[model samples]
Target: MPRRTGWRVCSVPGCPEFSDRGGKCDDHRREAEQRRGTARQRGYGREHETRFRPAVLARDPICVCPGCPQCSDPDSACARPSEHADHWPLSKRDLIERGLDHNDPKRGRGLCGLCHASSTAREQPGTFGLH
Candidate 1:
């Protein structure tokens, strides 16, 4: 008969104990948890922003640029249909002063990439009125 082996040790570098699922020791597992928590706090851990997606869905999927209508085309070689979520009516200084959150529904709206670029350029001194 074959002899049974004991619990497998953690595979994470520098870890010395076993984990049933993650291959991490308890200390490393806790560290990994801490890292995940920090990432969530910083807004990089989740796939969807809380408000942006629903708001965009509620509105037409088309770009909101005046005189220009386009759909989202994530992979299009052409620029018109590419979607960009942009902050409206708010200057960079305003956003910095208010510390606007990117996910805030009241602070953002959808636009085409070209329109977004144009709006950004309009905010620059030399580019104003050019678009």
Candidate 2:
């Protein structure tokens, strides 16, 4: 087994705790998650879990991001399995305000967890740069 080593300062802006996790320390991690709210609070309720998510995943069993290309091109796309059903070209809030079905599978795309997190951090305001 590989050894677990290395530590960095906690990412809570002057918290002054060295963490092997690369983000917040254990004490602060829980606090951060609580502040972020639960999945239902974030609008991923039953419909999203049961209908929209399953359909999108079925349609795209693999990551569809440009970085995860399916062709022979090496620098095109990823080969990671899809793990998230993401809203494309619009967020759930944007769809709702426009009187659209926010959970419609037609408006979703499949992405790997890494791709989804990266995309979310880049596209969603106030997600990054606050810390």
Candidate 3:
């Protein structure tokens, strides 16, 4: 007979998801994590999530990848619904040090899931600080 280890399902009513990390499923866990992020991850405070992020989202309702190398053709650009409100050119660290509100989303840019993933992976992965 094989030895047994136990994992539990999410505590949310009717949820069948399971995880070894906690009582919540991965989705719920991630949701809670986002809500409980450190100051920096949560963009320093309420202003970032409540004010800045919403404003940016409203300003750029769709992705603006103008057929660049990472995107498609200018004539037929990927104007997908933006999933991220990113700090332009500057990274999160840069913004934190210089102050998150200094620009008020001036350089903010909207990006789709694909664009956001590519940009973050390229800028934040193994070769970080190399650029």
Off by over 4 Å in 2: 1-5, 68-75, 128-131
- The deviation in Å at residue 68 for candidate 1 is 5.4
Please report, in order, the local distance difference test score of every candidate based on alpha carbons. 0.57, 0.82, 0.70
lDDT of 2 by residue, 1-131 (tens): 45577998888887998889688888899887887787887778999999999999999898888853333564777667999999987987789889999889999999999788877877785663222
| Model 1 bad stretches (over 4 Å) | 1-50, 57-60, 67-82, 99-102, 125-131
The true-structure Cα RMSD of candidate 2 reads 4.1
Model 2 whole-model lDDT (C-alpha atoms): 0.82
Clash pairs, candidate 3, are none
* Per-candidate TM-score against the hidden true structure: 0.39, 0.83, 0.56
**Top of the candidates by TM-score:** 2
User: Across residues 1-131, which tens digit of lDDT does each residue of candidate 3 receive?
Assistant: 34455788787789988877656788987776666766565445676677667777789889875663455465665778988887777876677688665337775788888877777776778542232
* TM-score rank order: 2, 3, 1
Cα displacement (Å) at residue 51, model 1? 3.9
Task: After the best TM-score superposition of candidate 3, give how far the Cα of residue 16 lies from its true spot, in angstroms.
Answer: 25
Clashes of 1: 0
Error of 2 at 30 (Å): 0.7
